[model samples]
Target chain A: MISFFKKDFLVHWRDRKEIIISLISPLVIIAVIGIALPGWVENPTKTLQIKVALVNADDEQAAMQEFRDSLAARSLPDDELLDIEQQLEQLSPIRMLKQVFQAEHVKEIVSMEELGNDDALQQLQEERIAAVVTIPDGFTLAALNKMVWNDGEGTALRIIAEKASLQVGVLNDIIDGYVQKLNVQSAFHHLLGADAGAAAIASDDYSGIGGREMVDGVETVTSFQYYALAISIVFALLLSVTMASKAITEKRERTFQRILLTGSQPFHYLMGKMSAAFCLSILQLSIIILISHFALNIFPGRSLLFWLGVSAVLVLLSLCVGALVVLFTALVFRLHDETANGIAFIFSLIAGTIGGSFVPIYILPDWLRSAGEWTPNGLSLAVLLQWIQTETVADLSVPLVKLAVFAIATIGLASWCFPRRGRI
Target chain B: MLEAMELRKVFKGRTAVDDVSLFLDQGESVGLLGPNGAGKSTTISMISSLLTPNSGDVRLNGVSIVSKPQFIRQVLGVVPQEIALYEELSAYENLKFFGSIYRLKGKQLEAKIQELLEMVGLRDRQKELIKTYSGGMKRRINIAAALLHDPQIVIMDEPTVGIDPQSRNHILETVRLLNREKGTTVLYTSHYMEEVEQLCSRVYIMDHGRIIASGTTEELRRILSGEDTLLLKLDKPNKDLANVLRSLAPIRHVEETDNGLKLIIAKHSSLLSQIVQTAESHQVEIINIHVHTPSLEDVFLHLTGRTLRD
Candidate 1:
């Protein structure tokens, strides 16, 4: 058995170019994916800078002068005069709206460009601006009347954006929070009247629900980790295909017969082949993962135990690769050499595709994603990604068990199809 | 002695080996001779325990080895028709791997590989990959690999199939020495009649998955003793003259050749004089004429009605 293992290892080692080439595909995949997916893999807390046209048609000074004139005409008593002054001080709706766009989080995410309503719509249609927020010419009187006296229709902040873009979603959520806070302030004003209502508005916190809290000071997995795992599984499948071809080449070269003549049992020979494949695959995965970790920083903030858990899952994946190679070679050898090679290549390609090695699983249709998860490498990628997010052995149990079952089934079929001596 | 009794094998409803049997004594160099697809390889495979017979048994030292293939394999060295080697690895590495399989290691395995390499005339090129070697060199290494374990019986199946004359002669000589000097039991299978005629004391002539005849060369040739082969070497081609000679009553078979005509005649016939007179009348210059006894080729023709390479 040792001799068989040593022979396989030496033969593969002599053709080191193939090994290097195999390692290259996965790296290229990970690099291309990391570069292609820009914002998705980044820290969720990172803000987006959207250029929005702010069409403010409100004439705030004119509205304030009109309100003071109306109050002077009343010639109110001393207490009534004090109450009116306080109400006037609290009635800066234009200032409040401006502050909404200037808040710390909102300011980082959106930059306001003041423009006429017609020009804002033109910029929006041309796609030069991400969105348009039009504050109508209602000025402050409408807001003050609607809030304190409930005498007129409330002013609306008209927002225009493309339905498909992330900018639309961000702007909509932010505006929704503002509307909610304003309603809370309105309710307090109705209950306590104008003088004490100003205090209620001060305490209203409009931070959106999607805020990121630093958990254990550890960052979540980046986009690099997703593609790194994806590419690793893909190349591992390719490696299995090569291994099957290698077995066929050996059979053609007649080296398999020589080994059989040396009194080596069929089981011993297969075990040696599986062992060599497993070792090489594990080694390949380890190199790829470590390079991605240290160079590309795939799973930043992962602990030692996290990596160890990853290694354990990778070991299972590598064993599955080994068994898959055996099964593919055995099954293909039942046909002519050329036909067998074609089938093996097609099978590998299908497995890679369904395994989400080329495209991210989340982008796939729901049914396809579910179907892909049942595939060998697909399950492996899913379990691994989950483990990266929450490093726990329990998360790997289903995939690990499924991989074991798959390995057993493939190995058994391989044994059944494997040609014994004198048959070929 | 290694013995195969009533061995039979079927592949896809075709009888590849049909009730064939043969034996090799402890120190005898036996040859299994047949044309291509004549079941010689199949027989060798069964006898060497690399293949199992469907309805027969093989015994090593009077005990059935069908259930104990490891025992038979341990005592058998097989050189298949194909090179059966790792072309990417060095010749030395190939030998080391095979030696390890037979449980030989360290200095002992290394020394055996060196000795075999010297025997096969490849000692200097041990470090080179087998792929870099010529066809003849590969054949030599192939033989060396089989002999690594120094098995009690060496079964070689067409070992000299596509090599140069020098390597071919080298391999025949090497097998001869192994059998003569080391007293290794050998089962050499081939379609080359001269190789078997030169190396093996006993020969088994197989045809269509059955051994048609098995005996010493002299013993097998005696089957054709009643007829004599008349060899005539002429200066040039004489088709009309050869046709006239074929018309004679005493001639059993006449084969026209580039130089002359070969005729099979009765053991003591006056056809020789008639043939000479006819050749002179046809103006065909006779370079040489000789009457010889039958050989293994004739024996094969006598048994199978075709040449060994048919």
Candidate 2:
């Protein structure tokens, strides 16, 4: 087994092009993307300024104020007054919408400019603004009627942006949050009636809803920190494929058979290939991490313990990637080299996307985000990112266990697929 | 001793080895001769334990090794038809790796590698990468790799295919030494009849997945004992004269040639004088006349009616 591993190690070392490509490709990708992505993701307010038109088109503001004054003049009972006040708060959709945009994260993401309908639409087309938010006329009155009387009428807000623009999605997310909050309020009013709803609303806690925790006292995460680890996972997978390709070449050259005939078992050959991949992955991961830590300064400025935790997670991830490629190669052992290449490339893309190697997990749909966290790559990055945020290794146990299970399952599958006494 | 009894292997409903049985004494050299796709490789693969026979079993010494292949595998050395050594590694490295697999290490492994390299006549070039070596040189290293462990039996499957004559001769000489000096059993397989004829004490001829014949070279040649082949080198071509000679009663078969005519007749037939006289009468001068001995090639043609290379 040692002999098999040594042969594979020495062979890969002799291939200067493979070694160079494995080490250099990740840095190049990270550098290109790190330089190309807008700096807004790193420091939203200090970087590129995206403009949003916040149009207040509600013409019923005067009427709603007059209604509130009339209710006060009618000398209503104390409990009735309190119920009306609670209902008024629930009916303030425009206020709720304005507050969501005013939040720190969104405020940093886009600068709002109040504009008329025509000017906002014109600005959006001219690319002066990323999106336009139009509060329709009678929006306040409609919202009030829906909440106070359980009216079935619906109100709509208009948003205009270029198709598939990132800012449009961000704006939609904020609006969705407001709509969810309104639904919760409406449900409570229908369940308890105005008097009981007022009591329930007063006692209900709203502090935790849509709340953001500052990691290391900073609300923003740098894009470099993301790709620093994301690209490392991607490149680690590609390097493992390169190792698998070398294994295939050895099979084609008949050296694999030679080793087997020398009394090395099939799993011994697998161990050799796995060890080579694991060793290279560690080297690749170490170099990429160290560069990100020291040169790029993308890693959290934490002590050695923090980086050690991060490294431990990455090591497991690297092993999983290596084992994954081994299984992939074994499954496609009879294919042509080109087909093998195509499979590897397509697998990398899919695993990267599903594992959050190309995009941050938090930005994905909830189900997909959950799925990404379970994947070896995403879990590794999650652990790293978590360690960076908490500056501790407390949240690493689950991911480490997951990574171990993934590695074992893949290695077992690969071993089972490997031919025991024949050419593979 | 290694014994294979009634071994059969069917691949996807097509039989590759059919009820084949072979045995090797501790020190005897055995050869398997056949054309391409003739089941020689399949037979060796079964004996090497790299492949399992669908039926029957192979035994080393006394025990069947089908379930416990490593027992025989440990004592066996196989050099496949392909150049199976790592091309990117030096000959020394390749030998060391194989030696390690056989559980040899330290100075002992180094000494054995040196000895095997010397045996294959590649000691001075052991440090060069195999990729840098000539085809013949690579073949020598390939043979050297198999001998590193000094196994009880060495199985070489067409080891000299596609190499220069020098390397082929070197490999033959190495096998001769292993069999003659060290008394190591060998099972040599090849399509090259001359290689088997030169090295094998006993030979097995296979065609279409079954052994056609097995014997010493002389014993196999005796299959054609009753016939004598006569070759006449003519000074000039004469189809009419050849036809006239063919009408003689003793002649069994006559085949035209570029420079001569080959005649097959009864072993005891004394028709050479009659044929020469007949040729001279037609003004067809016989420049030289020679008798042809039956070779393994003739035996193969007699059995399969196809050349070994075909």
Candidate 3:
């Protein structure tokens, strides 16, 4: 077994063309894609700057006074009226809308300018701004009345744009989410009681609505990191085909028959090819990552524990590649044709395509993306991306187990497909 | 001793070997002689346990190896017709790997590799990659790889095909030394009759997936002893002269050669004058005429009615 392994390793190592192709091809692709399509991999909104005209017609103080007068007219108890006033002060719809727009993340992508209704419309028509957001008169009073009494028709925030664009779509979603939250808070108040509703409105969770919170200091994945890992995995998958191609040569040359005559077991021969692919995959991935990190800082300032996690993932991914090599080798011997390499190549290409190696998982259709996550490379890329961000050891468990299962299942299938004694 | 009993092999509805049976005694050098499509290689494959016969069993020392191939694999070394070696690796590396697979290791493997390389006359070029070597050099190394384990039996299938004379002579000499000095049983197969005649004490003549004849070289020669081979070199083409010779009573078979006509005739028959008279009557000049005892080539031609190369 060791002899077979050593021979396979030496054969691959000595083939300068194959080695160069395995290592250099991925690095070139990663560099090119990373430089060419950073925004696609990174935050899509980073390159989009949406300009909006804000028309604030409702006066906050007047709306509050009107709400108080209406409450007094109803002859409600002073304590309940005071509590309602307090809730109104904290949950002013106009003020909250302003805060949502003023959020740092929101401000990064959207620029809002206050203008009169006429001027805002004019700007929108001229395409100087992406859209016009209008807070109609009596909005706050109407909103409060709807929340407390559920008697009056609710006021709606209106947005006018010349055409439906990404900016307008983003603006619409943001406002829609905000209004839904407000309505939810009102429902909670009515269902649970005054104190519960006020508490929900006073939580201030809505203040950071525009930005995502950092959980446990997890960082965002950059384009460099994504392509670095993705392309490396794609190339590593090709290594299995490369190893199988060598097996084809061995069979064509009758070296495999010679080995059999020496009393070497077929299992040992397959394991030798698998071990070679495993080692080469690890080396190929490590080199790609190291160079990418040094040249572009793909994984900057990652902890030792983080690297250890990465190593664990790398090892499992390599094993999966090794198992694929076995399958390809078995196919080569069974089919006794060069088409085995082509079959392995097509398999790798499909896996890479569906596994998010060529594109981000978010862009794929929901079904394909889900399937992609199960692919070894796709799963590894996702896990590595998560590891880069979350650094959570627990997140590694399911993917690691899945990868191991994939490896074992593939090896079992390959063993079954392998040619039996005298068949070769 | 190794024996292949009534072996038959079919490939995709075509029979490659049919009821072929042969054997090798310990320390004996035997040759399987045939044309290109003969079942010699297939027979060797079955005996070496590389292939299983469809309806036969190969035995080693009275033990059936069909169900237990490992029995023969442990002591068998097969030098396939193709250069069955890693071209990207050096000769020494290839030998080391083959030796290691057979359980030789460390200094023992290294020494065995060195010994085989030297024996194949490739010691000085052992470090060079097999791909860099010439065809003959590669073949030499291929033979060396088979001997790395120092097995009790070595099966060579057309090992000297497509090589220069020097390499061919070297490979034959190596086989002779292994058989004579080391007492290694040999099962050699080739289409070249001279190679078999020079190296093998016994020979099996096969054709069309069956063994037509088998015996000592002298005994096989005796199959043609009842007749003699006549070589008549003609200066120019004459279908008439060949036809006339074929019609003669003493001549049993007449075959056209590149430069002449070969005739098989009854032993001690005096038909040369009649052939000369016939050729003169046809106005065909006889460049040379000679009569000799039948060799293996003549024997094959006599049996198959075709030359070995044909």
Candidate 2 docks with a DockQ of 0.39
lDDT of 2 by residue, A98-187 (tens): 666676666666678889889998988998888888898877777766666566575778888866566576667667666666666667
Residue A306 of model 1: what lDDT?
Answer: 83
Of the two candidates 1 and 2, the one with more favorable DockQ, higher being better, is 1
Give per-residue CA lDDT, model 3, range A1-424, as digits (tens).
Answer: 7788899999999999998898888888888988888766667666556999989988878988888887878988888877887777677788778877887788877899999999999988898998999999989988888777876778999999999987788888789877887788789879998778767766656544455345656588888888889989999998998888888888888999998887888899999988988998999999999999998877767789999999999999999999999999999999957578778988898899999888777667898988888889999998998898888999999999999999999999999999888888
Give the lowest summed-lDDT range of ten residues in model 1 chain A. A203-212
Ranking by lDDT: 3, 1, 2
Q: Which of candidates 2 and 3 reaches a greater DockQ?
A: 3
**Colliding residue pairs in candidate 1:** none
For all the candidates, what are their Cα RMSDs to the real structure? 10.5, 6.8, 8.8
DockQ of each: 0.40, 0.39, 0.58
Per-residue lDDT, model 1, residue B233, is 96
- Candidate 3, B48-94: lDDT as tens digits: 88788899899899999989988888888889999998989999888
CA deviation > 4 Å runs, candidate 3:
A43-218, B237-256, B265-284
lDDT of 1 by residue, B88-146 (tens): 88999999988998789899999999999999999999999998999999999999999
Return the candidate ranking by DockQ, descending.
3, 1, 2
TM-score, candidate 1, is 0.71
The alpha-carbon root-mean-square deviation between model 2 and the true structure, to one decimal in Å, is 6.8
Select the stronger candidate by lDDT from 1 and 2.
1
